[model samples]
Target: MSLRWRITLAIALVSTLVALALSLTVHFAYAYRQAEQARQLQTQRLELALEEYDRTGQPGLRSQLNDPKLPDRLREAASEGGTAAMVTQTPQGAVVWAALSTTGGDTLSLRSSYQPQLDDRASLDRVLLMGAAALIATGTGAGVVIGARLSRRLRHAAAAAARVADGDYSTRVSAAVGGRSRDEAAELAQAVDAMSSALQNRLQAERQVTADIAHELRTPLTGLTTAAELLPEGRSTELVRGRIAVLRDLVEDVLEVARLDTATELPELSDIAVGDFVTRRVATYSSEPEVRVATETVVATDPRRLERVLANLVSNAYNHGRPPVVVEVDGPRVRVRDHGPGFPDEVLAEGPGRFRKGSGGGHGLGLTIAVGQARVLGARLSFTNADADGGAVAVLELPVSEGEDAPGR
Candidate 1:
């Protein structure tokens, strides 16, 4: 049975049992009290009979056989369940007097030769049984009502939670006065709602990212193919090589993003000095690289991911910015600044989104790849066009793991 029915049935059964026990106890008590009263009446009748017999000296006193008052007393005693019987004892033996009782469900035998019987009230007892049953029925009905309310509220909450699980984060249970608020159902609903909102935000972000990826990938692919076709018969060495390099960069950018997106390449993070890594990347850059730092730091990070992150940023700046790019390391992050015409209003507004770039003529995959890599590496990436001049800045933050100390100034 459903929880509601089970709960109702349990309550009803318990109530019935309690009522049955109580009714039986009351019935027994009444029976005992009535028996006591009957016994008292018999005793009083015997006392009165002895008194009259003493006054009249009636050893064989049958009240003159027709004394109406004596016979009437005997009849009254019989009616009251006294079962009046006389037994004569002659030192040899005594005759038996019959048993008597006010009510009878079982027969009683007495020492005297007489018997009295009065039927017990089965109808009154049946009425009490019916009354107890009626009370149980009423209690059961009340239990059913309560269980129904509880089950209804529970069902409502369950439905709402299911909807949220199916991605409808806007789902909410109606908070009536009698709701699942008294149990885990309320907490479950709240959790579902929260999960739905989070899912919505993530889906939206992924959609935007997908659209940007398409746009960004199209550029380098098209440019690389065009550059190949444009080769006027056995392309010049320099032109062919430059086009090939561009193609390589484009392919690497896509691969980098794919790996990060799928988490195929996990960050093998470990303790590494931030200054040393940045310095190495700066040295690798052919263009004049400027480095600035207010603090030197060590952070837990995948060195490979760290290197890739720095490479993407430096490459993006090199391609789009003027010479003498300024890279700075402070706190838990590194920032690369390009002293060139910074990003356009659209690119700046889009933040770290895909298909977004500075004045770089190639695909916008560089920054896109950067963002994906940072995500896989469990870091943060952001970009802003410079307000001071024509410089654009890219910020990459590495989250500090437990037991890692802060930057040392």
Candidate 2:
């Protein structure tokens, strides 16, 4: 359940429990007080009847004993005990008090019919019902209002967190509540804002360092390549040339990654047939991935960047996997599967990272670059092990270009 409902439910339950406790307390207290007052009044009436009997020396002197208003219980009390009192309900739901006493060996009885006046029990029940309803309404309203307010604030914090996760380092939680009232939630918002600022600073610093290193290495790297080309044709010269090429490529890849981190490499989106793009890119590789196109669709993406992504994936498969790299295009989605040992547990779990190589050769920026380009294209890139064979399967889901036919399932 959402936070709003959870908190509201808790408040409602507590309110009900408190109301029930108080209602029971009031009910019991009123019953006890009424019982005590009835007992004292009955005792006084019985004492007066006994005094009248003592002075008159005649049972008939107290005419109420003979009257029809007297209850049968009072007559029974007079016959059974010399002194006693009782409150009882009659067959018609009427309440009565009965008492018996003796004076000069003459039995005397007393009674008083109980009929509520202004403080009738039925009217009290109506009042109690209204009060309970008002209490519940007030408590429920307060819970909803409070729960909604808290939910709004928490949702704002959660949205800011989501934006930060989505690579929007500029996103920060607003600490508006701090100025008026600094509650726990406001403190949490402040903390989130601080964390976002820290992340932005650290990531920007890292990107700047990478860009600086790449820029510094390029001048010497070009000079070294030119020197290697001038060297006489020999084993040593060939080895040096090869190593220089590798170093140059590494520098270039680092600069590209730094650009991606800074989001300076925006996609030049264009309409390209998904099937054709897959076929042409696969042809560039020597391993020649098996291509399958079922229900082709067009995608809007930067062709060069898309080619780069395909090249890196195919290269990884050929170098690391066993054999038979298969590339399948279904609608706007492409899948590359290799029949080899699957991706490393860490890569599959933690996702690809720059400089973090898998169990393969070469610098680890290939998958990282691919992922970054995919983001620029507003597409999704995922890696998983094939269900049947435990081989790495990379899927790229691209957004459909405008005015293109919708992709079939």
lDDT of 1 by residue, 1-409 (tens): 9989998999899889988898888788866665555545544554444445456644121222223323333445455654564333434343323222223222122232112211354555887788898989998998999899778877887777677554455666544223434566566556656666787778757755754774577777777767776667654856776767776666666655655554445677788878777887678767757888767778888887777778878888888877668889886789998888776666667655555645567778777777777877789988887777778898988888777767764
Candidate 2 weakest lDDT stretch, 10 residues: 58-67
Which regions in candidate 2 have their CA more than 4 angstroms from the true location?
59-100, 105-107, 113-119, 175-179
Deviating ranges (above 4 Å) for candidate 1: 1-237, 263-265
Q: Output the lDDT of residue 235, model 2.
A: 100
| Residue 343 displacement in candidate 1 (angstroms) | 2.3
Backbone clash total for model 1 is: 12
Please provide, for model 2 over 1-409, each residue's C-alpha lDDT reduced to its tens digit, 9 standing for 90 to 100. 8889888888888877777777777776776677667767767766766676668765442334444545566666666766555666666554545456463434455555555622465576676677777777788888889998888888877887888887877776764332356788888888888888888899899989989999999999999999999999999999999999989999999998898888766789888888988998898776788999987887778999889888988888877786899999999899988999988888889888778866667888889988988888888999999879778999999887567766783
Error of 1 at 166 (Å): 17
Each model's C-alpha lDDT? 0.66, 0.78
Report the alpha-carbon TM-score of model 1 versus the true structure. Answer: 0.45
